[model samples]
Target chain A: MTGFGHNSEDEAEGRIEALAEMMARLPGLGPRSARRAVLHMLQRRDLLMTPLADAMHDVAAAARECVQCGNLSTAETCAICREERRANGEICVVEDVASLWAMERAGAFRGRYHVLGGLLSALDNVGPDDLRIPRLRGRIADEGVREVILALPATVDGQTTAHYVADAVEGSATVSTLAQGVPVGGELDYLDDGTIGAALRARRSL
Target chain B: MTGFGHNSEDEAEGRIEALAEMMARLPGLGPRSARRAVLHMLQRRDLLMTPLADAMHDVAAAARECVQCGNLSTAETCAICREERRANGEICVVEDVASLWAMERAGAFRGRYHVLGGLLSALDNVGPDDLRIPRLRGRIADEGVREVILALPATVDGQTTAHYVADAVEGSATVSTLAQGVPVGGELDYLDDGTIGAALRARRSL
Candidate 1:
C-alpha cells in the first residue's frame, strides 16, 4: 500500500505538501517537524487551527509597518504615535519591531518608539539611510523629543548603529541606552518582563 | 507616550489580542510565549505569516475527521480507507488518530486502521462504547478482517482496555498488542518512527 494511502499527485496531497513546505520555512521548524505540526493542526482545526488561520488572514490583509516608527500596524501611523498622550518628548529606539513589542510587553516604557528596521552592518553594506536614522533625527528636532533611549543589541553591529544614531542626534537630544546584565546573545523578546523593566529603569547615558 | 504609538483599543490591538489568545491555547504554549509568537508572526507577515495563515484557513474549511477511522481527512472516508490495496485484511488499531498518523509516517503497516479514540478508563467513567469498540467489532465481521493490532499506550487504563478488547474479539479474529520497550507514560504521539515500527514488528498476542 502507498504511504499515507494518498497519491502525492492528488489534490489533497498537494495541499498538505504545500502546507508542509511553508511550515518548514519557519524558524526552528524543519520538514519532519513541519509535517508533525501540520498533522496536529489538522486534528485540532476546530479550536486552534481555524482561529489561527483567520487571524493570519486578517493580519495579512490589514498589516503594514508604521511609516514613522517601523512598528507593525494597520495604519500609516502606529497607535502609539496617534495618541496625543504618547507624545511625551521621548523616543525608545530599537533594531526591529519585535524589540519594540518586547518593550511594550514590559509595560515600563511610556514613550514612543523609532524602529531602526535593522542595525548597521558594514559586512552587509547597510548604512544610515538604510535604517530610519534620518527620520529619527527629524523627529527629535521637530517633535521636541528630549530623551532618546537606545535598546539595541550588544553586538558589534548594534553598538555601531547605536553610536551612529547618538552622534547624529547628539546636540539636539539627550541620548541613553538600556544597561548591561540583560544577558549576552539574548533578544528583548526572550527577556522576562521584570528584567526588561529593570533594564529600562537602569538605563545609562550614551 | 505609548510604545509603538498606537491607541490602546484600536483595531490592531483587537487583532493582536485575538491572535495571542488563540496561540495561548496551542499545545506547549502559554500566554506570555503566545504573545511573543504573535509578535514574531506579525514581523514576518510577508514571508512566514501570510502563507501559514492561508494554509490554516484552507485546512480549517476543508479538513474533517474520517468518519470510519477518526483520521483527519478532507472527505467522508480517509485516503487510507479508500485505497483498495490498503484494505489488506489487517487493521492496526490505535488509541488516537495521532498514533495512526505516526505509523503512517514510518511508511510501514501496509493495512487499514481503526482509531479507538481513547482507551477504556473506569476512573474517568470511559467504557468500551466511549471508544470505537462497537465499530471495530462490526468491521471485523463485515470486512473479513484477519488481524486486529492494538497500539494503545501502556497506561493502566490502556492495558486494561486492550485486554477487554482482546476478550471481546477473541472468537471473531486474531488479536495482538504492540510489544513493550515503549516508555511509561509516553504517548504514541512522541515515539520515533523506528520505535513504533519495532513495537509493531514485535507485537504479541493480547
Candidate 2:
C-alpha cells in the first residue's frame, strides 16, 4: 500500500493517495495506472469527478442488499420485487447484483429478480446453505412464483449451482435457464443485448 | 445525461442500457465494450468494484492542478518542482501534466518539470499567451535554469509551440528535445518505460 512511487505533502495528497491506493487494487489498474487515472479525474473535475464522487457517496451511504433477493437497493426489498407490475408469477434468478442489473438493462424481462450473491463452489467450500437457496425456497411458497429462470455464469460452479437450484425447485415451480451459445465461462452481464435477448427468448426447460 | 437511459431507480430495466451510457463517456471506453466491462466489474466486485469506487472517491477529492505548472498536484508546486535536488539548473518542458508524469514514471530525469498546459493551435486560435510561454522565460531568468528539455508531442501544434519556446529561451539556456521516432500522436503516457528511457538517452539538439 505504501509502495506507490511518488509522494508529496500537498493537502490533497492524503485524499489523492487514498483514492490511488483503492484504484491500484482494482483488476486492471496498478500503482502507476491508478496515479494516471487519479490525475485524469482531477483534470476533469467538473464534468466527471464531481458527479462520480456524489454518486459514490450516495451509494456508499444508501446502498443495501435487498433483504429478500440480495439485489442492491435503497430499501429493504429491491425495486424489482416491490413493483407489482414485475410480479407476473415469474422470477429471474442471477448469481450477483451486477447480473440482475444487466437483466434489467436489457428491458426484456417483466419479472422480479433473485440475487444468489455467488455460486455454490465446492472448491471454495461454498454450498447450498452458503447461497440463497433457503430464501429461494421460501419465495416459491410465499409468492406463488410460477417460473424460476436461472441466469448464472457458464463456469462449472455456476452450472452446478444452477442445477442444484433447479433440483430444489423441481416440484415447487417451473425451472428454466438462459440457453447455451452463451460463451463458456461468461457471465450474463457480458452478453450483448441481442445475445441476452436471444438467450432469454430461447430459454429451455431445466 | 438523463438520455443515456440510466434509471437507477427502475429495477425493471436491464443493466446494458446503464452500462452503454457510462461507457460512452469513458476516455478509452465505448458503448459496445462498456457492457462487457460493467459485467466484468460486477462479476468480481470484490476484485474490482470496491476498489474502483474507492479509487474514484479518493481521486475525486484530492486531485487538483499545480497552480505553478499545471501538473496534477495536491499542492501549489508539484513534487518534482518542490524537491531541492531536482532544481539542479535544469527544467524539462512538456505540453501537459500527463507527459510530465510519464517522464517521472520512467525515473530517468533528474530535473524539475514545466508543463505548458497545451500546444499552440492555430485553428483553435490558441496563442503563446494561452500557454506557459512567458512563465518558461521567467523561470530561466529567475531560477538560473541552464538547460531546457522539450518533450513535446509530434503534432503540428506541438512542434510549433516547441520551436516558439526554443526561440524565447535560445540565449538563456541550452534547448533540447526528445529525439524523433517516439511516434506521432502517441502520448508520452502510452510509451513503454524502455522507449521513454531510450528517447531520453538519445535526446538531440532541438
Candidate 3:
C-alpha cells in the first residue's frame, strides 16, 4: 500500500481532498481556506484534528431539535424550554435557532423562546404553515403565554411572518416586534435612511 | 433526559459549545462564526454534519507523513517519491508540505520533492540538524539527484534556510533559488525594494 506507486496514493489524496471539500461547505470557509484548514488540522492531528472530529461526531449523534421550541437540543425539549421558571407567560419568537441563541447570549430575555426555524418568504414560497406558527399558537394557549414578542429580522419576509403569527394568535396573547432604530454605539452617518427614519419616529422624551 | 432540565441539559449545551470551540481553533473561523457554523451543521445533520464528521474521521485515520519527503500520504513514501519516472535527478526542496502541495498544484515541476518541515530561524534557535538538511544530503547522493531547486518563501528565514541548503549540497548537485521580482501580473509600484533590486541585478537580455 506504500512505496509501489499504485492507485492507493490517489485514494489517500482523495480522502484529504474530500475532507477539504466538506469543510468548504461550512459558512465562513471557501475552497482555499478549507484546504488550508485541512492542512493545519493534518499538521496537528493529535492536538486539533482528532479532537475536532470527535467533537463533531458527538454533536452529530446527540443534537436534535427541541420538540417545544425547535431549538437544537440533545433531548426532546431544550434547556430553556424545560426550565420551569422560564415559563414566565412570555414567549419570544425568532426566525431560527441562531437568533434564539443570540437572545440567550445577550441574557436579556429571561422568558422562554419559540424558534420558527424560518420566516415566511413569498419569494421562496414559504407560508405560515411552513414555519412553526401553528405550534406557536398551540404554545400560547397551552402554556398560558401572555406575550409573544417577535424577535425576527427586519426583512420583508420576517415582518410578514410576524404579522401572520400575530393574526394567528390574535385573541390569545399580546403580539409585539423587536424595536427598530439605530443600534447601540451606532453612528448616525453609517446608518441607512430607513433606520434613521425609524429612530426619529420612535424618539423617546428623554 | 428528554424533559428533565437538570445537569443533562448543561451537558447537552456543553457538547455544542465544545464543538464550536474546536471549530474556532481553525485558521479562518472565530468564536461567532464557529457558533454559527455549528448551528448550521446541527440544522442539517444528516445532509452536511454527518458527512463532514465521517470525512474528517476518515482523513484523521488514514493521513500520514511520507517517510522519504515528509509530504502527506497514507503510505510510507509519497506518490512522487515512489514514481520511477519522477526520479528525474531533480529534487525541489521546500519548507513544508503545503509548499510541496502548492508546487504540485502548479504542475510545473516534474521531479520529486524534499520537504524540510520548516526553515532555519535564528530567533527560534532552529539549526541545520533541526530541519531535513542531513536527510536531504543523503537523498542527493543516494538518488543521483542533479539539481536542488529551493522554492522557499522570500522571508528572511526562508532566504537563510535556502543559503544553508545550497552550501550543504554544494558539490553533490547544482543549487538554485527561485527568481524574485514583481509577480507576473504585479505592477512595479506594489513590489518591495528588495524585489526591485533583485530584479534589476538579475535582468536578462532578449
Candidate 4:
C-alpha cells in the first residue's frame, strides 16, 4: 500500500477541494460545513449546483452599488431610489444593505433608504470618506428630505456614526434613531442591562 | 408612507433576493446566514465573489465520478484508480467521496479505494444494484485483491451494506472492518451508550 499519489491533489479532488475552500471563507461556513456543502452541490449538480453557479455569476456581473443611496443595484440607482413614491420627504440611514433589506422585510418603513456602506471605525482606519456619508448629506438637501431615521446597530461605532450624521445634517432635517429597548416578544430577564435600562427610561403610558 | 412597491420584487433587489434564496438552500446555511454570505460576497466582488463563481463553474463542468472506483475525477479513472502502485491487492470500500477524502486525509491506508455512493437503506429503497457492490466484487477477482477493508459507518444501513459486500466477496478476498473503540482524544463519559458498548465488546489486552 502507498500514500495518496502526488497528482491526486492536482486532479478532480483538487478542483472540489478548491471550491470548498472558497465556500469555507463565506460568513457562516467553516471547513467541515464547506466540504458538506460542496459535496451536496456535487451530488445535485443539475438541480442545485449549476443553478447556484449561474445565479452567482449573474449577480457578480450585474450587481452594483446604487450610486445615489449605496443600495444594491444593476443600474445607477437602486429599485428603491428609482421609486417615485418612496421619496416621501424621508430617508432612513442604515449601516449596510443588509439592514435596508431587513427594514424592507419588516414592511414597516415606507420611506426611501440610504446605505452607509459601513460605520465610522477609527481602529480599522475606516473614516467618513470611506463610507457613503458624504452622499447621504448631499441627498438630504437635494431631495428636500424632512426627516432622517438612523437604523444603525446598537454598537459604539453605530452610535458614533448616527451622531456624526445627525450633526452633519443638523438644521437640514429632523434626525432620529430606531428606539432602543427589549425586542418584541423578548423576556425581561433575558434582556441585557443596557436594554432594560433603555426600555425603562423610554417607557410610555399604555 | 406606502408598502414596498409592487415592482420592488421585480427589479435589481429581485436579482439579489433570488441569489440569496438560492444560497440559503445550501447545506449549513439558512435565510439570515445566506443573506450575510451574499452581502459579504457582494462587498468583496473582486476579492471573493467572482473567483468563487468561476471555481464553482469550473467544477460543475469538469467533475465526474471515476468509472472504475466511483471516486471524483475529471477523466475516465480517478487519480487513485490510475495509479499503478495502488493496485497492491488491497481495496478500501467507503460510502462516498467524502469518506474517500477522509481516508485520504488520514493517509493511514495505502491501497486504492472504492466509493459506494450510498448505503443500503430499506426505507429509502436503496439496494445493492443501486450502489457499486457489483463493481467491488468484480475488482476483487480482477485486481487479485487480498483484503477488502470496509470503512463504512456504524449505522444500520452501513452495517447492512458492509455485510452484503462481505458476503458478495467472501471467497474472492478477505474482508475486514475498522476497529470500534474509544476515539482518540474522546472522553468516555461523553460517549454514547452504543459506542461504549462496542468499545467494551471489542476491547483487547494491553
Candidate 5:
C-alpha cells in the first residue's frame, strides 16, 4: 500500500472521475449510478457511447426552445407551430417539457402544447411576468378564436395561475380545466378527500 | 385528431424520436425514461446537455482498452502498466473490466491487474485460448511475477479457470484464490449452509 501505489500517474482516473461527476448531474442518476453508467459506457465504447456522444453533440448544438410555443425544437419555430393545420382552435397548455411529453405519449390530445417552463410559484418568486403569460395572451388573440385547455397541476399556485390565465384570455377564448377525478388505474380508496368530493360533484349519469 | 395534424413536415419529430430511441439503449433506460431524459436534455441544453456531450465526445475519442491488461484507458497502454511501482511481482486476475474496477474501488491490492474478459466456460465454448490466458502467461514470465491472485467468481466456470491458472503457474509463481466466507455483516441464520461452513472453516481467532 505504501511503496507500490498508482498516485502519481492517475490521468485516466481523473478523466473517468470527471465523466462520472458530470453524469451524476443528470436527473434520476446519483453518484454511484453515474459511475456505473460511465463504466458501462466505457465498456461499450464503439457501440453505445460513441453514437450517444454524436447524438448529444448534434442535439446540443441544434436543439432550441421554439420561440412561438416554448417547446423544444431544432428550428426557429417548432414543427407544431410551423404546421398550419395544428392551429385548429385549441391550445393545450402544460407546465413543463416532461408534461408535454406525457401528453404526447398519450396521444389523446389532438392540439399542440404551450410549455409554461414552470408553474407560477410565489414561494419561489415565480410570477406571471416571469413565465410565458404574455405569449399566451398574444397567441390567443392571433391563433384565431378557440378553446384553451389549462392542463396545469392541482396545487394552489397552479390554480392561481389558471385563474390568471382565464382572466387574461377572458374575452378572446373559452378556458377549461381538466376534469377532477380518480386516475384511470387509481382506486377510490386511495383518492384524497378533496379529489373524492370533486369527483362526486362532477359525476354524470350514464 | 383526424383533420388537424403535422403530417407533411415531420423532420423535428423524427429527430426527437431518434434521440429518444438512442437514449433508451443505454443501461437503466427504457422508452419512458428515454423520453424524459431527452426532454430534460433539450430543456437544459446550455448547462447539462452541452457539457455532457463534450465530455462524452472526448471520452469516446480518447478512451481505449489497455492492451496490456484489458482495462479501460485513454492511451494504448494503461497508466497502471506504465507505472513501475505498480509492477509489484503480483497480478490480480479478474473476470471482466467491471471486476477490475471493483478491485480498484477497494484500494486493498497494491499490485496491478489482469482482466480475463470472461471465465472459461465449457458450455459457452469459452476455452483458455479464447481469453487472455496466453497474454497472462507471457506477462508472468516477462514481468518477473511471483504471485497470481485469482479474484474470480465462485461459480463453476470461475473455479475451473482458477484451477487452470494455478496449474499453469505452478512451478514459476504462487497461486492464491480469494477467501470465501460469509460477508462482514452477514448473519449465520441468513447465510446458506455452504457459506456458514466456509465461515466456520475461515474463522480467525483474536
Candidate 6:
C-alpha cells in the first residue's frame, strides 16, 4: 500500500498529495483525514467540491477584515460594525474571530465587538502590539465605548490580557468578563476541585 | 450573536453561508463545523485558503476515475492499472476505490485490482450489471488471469456476490477471499462467539 499512492505523489502526479497536504492544514484535519477528504471531494466534484472551490475563490478574492473592529467581511466595514443599532456604547473584546462568532451564536450581547486577533503570548514572542490591542484602546476612546466586555477564555494568557485591557481603559470604561463558574447543566460530581472551590467562593445571590 | 450571523446569512451576503452549506456536505462536517471552517479559511487566505482553493480547482479540472478499475486519478487509467509489473496473473476484486486503496495500503497485494463499484443489492435494485461483473469476467479471459481474490466485506451481500463471482470463473480461474477469522491485534477474549467458532474451524498448524 505504501507504493500505491507513493508513485502518484512523484513528479508527474503530485497534485493529489499537494491537495491532501494543504487540507491537513485545516483546523481539525491531519494527513490521513486530509487524504480521505480529498478522495471524497474528488469523487463528488459536481455536487460538493466544485461549489467549495468556487466559494473559496470568491471569498479569497473578496474577504477583508473590518477596518473598525477586525471582523471578517467583503466590504470596508463588516456588517456588524456598519449597523448603527450595534453602536450602543459597548464593545465586546474577544481573542479571535472564532470567539467573536461564538459570542454572536449566543445572541445575548446587543452591542458591537472588537477582535483582538490573538491572546498575548510572551514566551512565543506574541505581545500586545502583535494583536489589535493598540487598535482596541484607540477604539475605546474614539467610539465612546461605555462598557467593554472581555469575552476571552479562562486561560492564563486570556486573564492576563483581560487585566491589561482593564488597566488600559481604567477610568474611562467599565470592563467586565464573562462569568466564571460551573456551566449550566454541568454535574457537580464531575466538577474539578478548583471549579467547585471557585463556585463556592463566588456563590451568587440566587 | 445567533441572530447576527443569521441575518447576514439571510440577506444578499449569502455567499459565505452558501459556501458553509456546501462545506457541510463534506464527509465529516456539519453546519456549525462548516461555518467555522469557512470562517477560518477566510481569515487565513494567503497562507491556507488560497492554496486550498487552488488545489481544489486543479483537482476539479483534472480528476478522473480510472477507466480500467474505477480508481480516482487525473488520468484515464489509474497508476495501479497502468503499471505493467502489477499484471501478475492475479486480480483483487473490491467493492469501491477506498477498499482498493486500503489493499494497496497493506503493501501485501502486488497484483492489480478491479473495482466493482458496489455489491449486488436487490433491495437497492442493484444487479451484477450495476457493478463491473461482466467486465471482471471479460478481463479474466482477456488477461489470462489465474486467480481472483475477493476482498469484499463480510456482509450478506458481499458473500452472495463473492459466490456469484466464484461461480462466474469456475472453469477458468481459482477464486479466494480474505481470511474469515480474527484480525491481527484483536483479542480473542473480546471476539464474539461466531468469530471464535470461525477461527477454530479455519485453524491452521504452525
- Number of the top lDDT candidate: 4
Measured against the true two-chain complex, the DockQ scores of the candidates, in the order shown, are: 0.26, 0.22, 0.50, 0.40, 0.28, 0.34
- Reproduced native contacts, each prediction: 0.32, 0.24, 0.58, 0.62, 0.39, 0.39
lDDT of 1: 0.79
lDDT of residue B149 for candidate 2: 94
Q: Pick the candidate with the highest TM-score.
A: 3
What is the per-residue lDDT of model 2 for residues B94-185, given as tens digits with 9 covering 90 to 100?
98877986897789899888889888898999988898888888888888899999999877888899899999899999999977657768
Q: What share of the reference contacts is kept in model 1?
A: 0.32
Off by over 4 Å in 3: A1-9, B1-9, B187-197, B200-206
Q: Candidate 6: misplaced stretches above 4 Å?
A: A1-13, B1-13, B189-193
Candidate 5: stretches off by over 4 Å: A1-10, A187-206, B1-9, B184-206
Indicate the DockQ of the complex predicted as candidate 1: 0.26
For A92-156, candidate 4 gives per-residue lDDT tens digits of 99988889889998999989998888899898888988988888778988998999999999999
Chain A (alone) TM-scores for all candidate structures? 0.79, 0.76, 0.92, 0.92, 0.90, 0.88
The digit string of per-residue lDDT tens for model 3 on A1-206 reads 35444334446567788888889999999988898999999878899988888888888887777888988887667888878999999999998888988898899999999999898888898877788888888898899999989898998888888888888999999988889999999999999999999999999997
Better of 1 and 2 by TM-score: 1
User: Can you write out model 2's per-residue Cα lDDT over A158-192, one digit (the tens) per residue?
Assistant: 88999999999999999999876666687988877
lDDT score, candidate 1, position A51:
75
Candidate 4 chain A: minimum summed lDDT over ten consecutive residues — where?
A1-10
Q: Return the clash pairs for model 2, or none.
A: A101-B15, A104-B13, A104-B14, A105-B13, A105-B14, A105-B15, A106-B14
lDDT of 6 by residue, A1-206 (tens): 12233234323346777898988877667677778888888878887788888888997776667778988776656788878899899999998877887898889999999999888878777887888877887888888999999999888899988998888878888989888789899999999988889888888895
Judged by whole-model lDDT over C-alpha atoms, candidate 2 comes out at: 0.73
Candidate 5's TM-score: 0.84
What lDDT score goes with residue A127 in model 1?
Answer: 87
lDDT of 6 by residue, B137-158 (tens): 8889888899999999888999
**Model 1 alpha-carbon drift over 4 Å, by segment:** A1-17, A28-48, A182-206, B1-11, B43-48, B182-206
